[model samples]
Target: MNQNVQQAAAPGLGIEVSSKVPMHWYNLNADFPEPMPPALDPATDEPVRPADLEPLFAKSLIAQEFSSERYIEIPQPVREVYSLWRPSPLRRAVRLERALGTGARIYYKYEGVSPCGSHKPNSSVPQAYFNKIEGIERLTTETGAGQWGASLAFACALFGMGSETWQVRSSYEQKPYRRLQMGVYGSQCHPSPSELTESGRRLRGQFPDTTGSLGMAISEAVEVAAKDPRTHYALGSVLNHVMIHQSVIGLELLDQLEEAGEEQADVVFACAGGGSNAAGMMFPLLGQNLRGGSTTRLVAVEPAACPSMTEGEYRYDFGDVAGMTPKLMMYTLGADFVPPAIHAGGLRYHGMSPMVSHAVHLGLIDPIAVDQERSFEAGVAFARTEGIIPAPESTHAIAGALDHVTSGAARPGEVVVIGVSGSGVLDLAAYDGRF
Candidate 1:
């Protein structure tokens, strides 16, 4: 057995933990079949340089955003924080498989054990550390489902920095517990389109009764950072560096699977919002495939209500509603598009990550859309069998995995992994009144 791995005491339980955490984060940028499209300055329509992003992001993050290296060393400080919840458990979904009577084996990499109850902290910690070392006093960010806001708030608290977040209006009204969590972490939170910034006011004037979207929230947060020299914008997802920070998920999975005596997963299912969770779970394996090592199918499950990967057009689009941010080539449903207030608030973005979009465009990753009702059904079913209630966003992956198995697409004896990005403890309201 690898020194990093520890098998479960009970054999049939199939739960395994890693004694070690990955010291380096994997980057798919070096192995991408084609270079991803560069972010362009909205004003000049030319490629954005590191200096162009200096106003919004930390210098270290900007280097990562544009880095071509295959692996980057994880700072010891960041790694120390990660050790709190790194090497999260990987378990065989024996009950779930028996419930479905599927021949294929089922496994789930659970990331809810973090202090923030989600995978958002995987990047938030590093983002906070990087900004703190550079003398940044505060961080401004946007969140759709409140997970990112709470995670950033926790990270800022650890690094002794102030955090201000604008959450989507729908989620602000629906998920109050997440807001409370952020407040407990000593961060200020607001509903998007509030009268906080010029962008927010303009959006409110244009759509007075709008429920708000991630794009609008990003504009509000970015506006604040752009105007303040001591503050920097921290994005939860849809950025290259965020994706890289999240790669720890897959790196750990690679070792856990091998230590458990599994060769390779036949397919991996992960929910795609800004694509951070999916990228974190699949990027390492996809890198292997790029190097002609594995044939694992990386599946990105998105909401049918906001199907950026399946229905949106691939093109250069603004990352925010107000056009204050750079434009990147990706699958976009138009920055102005406001999706329905589905329970999966995080997946309601108008655009996918440029890196994920590039993989979709090249056929490296498979994209599928799941309806909200079906997703909730899957969540409820899994809770009954697995005894863990998945977050509304994570239900999309469960629904997708069930869809694949039920559709007879998965071969017998194949191993399938699901990325459970977070827990639904604070999201009980979404499950209220639903079966």
Candidate 2:
């Protein structure tokens, strides 16, 4: 058995601990397949092999690497800023186990305590760090649930830079706490398809009550960022670098589990929107798999309303709310598609992360989609059991765990790890309607 497994099986103090594994940048090209073309546009459809993305790929954060002793050092200032929230906690979910009435051991690596109240800051801090190091003075990005906006705002503030965020319209109206959170972090947030940009104005003109989409917000943010040299666009997910940055979560979890005296996880579950959180939690485990260790099932849970990984075609697609950004190969429903107005607004995107899409295609992971009602049911159950009201986005994963437990799919002594990516304190309104 691997050291992790051995430690997990050993008896002693139940505190989890992680090995000091040296951090390294993963080779994106080696792990992922060649990019494909967008499926929605046939006239412009064409293959987008990894070679074709050389220019864009070169700009990836992983592509720029340095080492300072144990940590593969990113550029300065960004690294310095990241020190503020570098190490997040990997927690044991004993509360969840008592609620499940199952013999399986369960743990959750909580990512809600970060400045932005989600795992988003894991990437946002790095993105802003790099942009500032590159002499950029302003950052622009789009937000669905406002977690990303708040994270970026916090990062920009740490780096003495300015940030502007385009919030999805439905989310802006439905999740006021998200906007308030972003505003607290010093980001200027505006509802997407607002009167601020021509695209927003035109979009509102067509769909007045349009609960904005990620694609539309991306179009506006990218337009604004690309227009000025001082401003650079930042993405919350859907890129290899973002996933790479998020590996810290898994790194910490690996240690935490060891401290908890548990063997390797039998199953690892996470909710995937653009796939950053799931990828982060899975990357270190992927390293274990590559080492010819015991196979631990990796699962990605998403909403049925926007089941990009489960139902969408693996093809090139636009990464924006309005289909205005450069197209990339990924698993996508459609760039023009609009998801249901679910409380998990962050998971409403029409596409999966390219790396996640590639991983799913290669059978490295499994995808499951649950509906809003069911997800909320899971979230409420988790709250009652775990005592942490999960964000709607994370409830999808909790629901999946509940399914496994209630169905008796997990055996006694088996272990399951779920990524509780955020807290649902901002989602009290969602709970008000649930009961």
Tell me the tens digit of each residue's lDDT in model 2 across 1-435: 466644422222233232242244343334333442232333356533443333222234534321112234444444444445455666666777876778888888888887677889878877776665567788889888888998888877666678999988888899998888778767899988788887888888888877778888887887787667678888888866777778778877777787888768889989998888888888677767755665889899999999998899987777875555557668899987888777798898898887678778888889999888998998998888768888889999888888987898999988898888998888778777786
lDDT of residue 408 for candidate 2: 86
Q: Among all windows of ten consecutive residues in candidate 2, which has the lowest summed lDDT?
A: 62-71
Worst lDDT window (10 residues) for model 1?
5-14
Model 1: lDDT of residue 295: 92
lDDT of 1 by residue, 131-247 (tens): 988999999999999999999999888777889999999999999999999999889999998898999999999999999999999999999999999999999999999999999
- Per-candidate TM equals 0.95, 0.86
- lDDT, model 1, position 199: 91
Q: What lDDT score goes with residue 413 in model 1?
A: 96
In candidate 1, position 167 carries an lDDT of: 97
Candidate 2: clashing residue pairs, number:
19
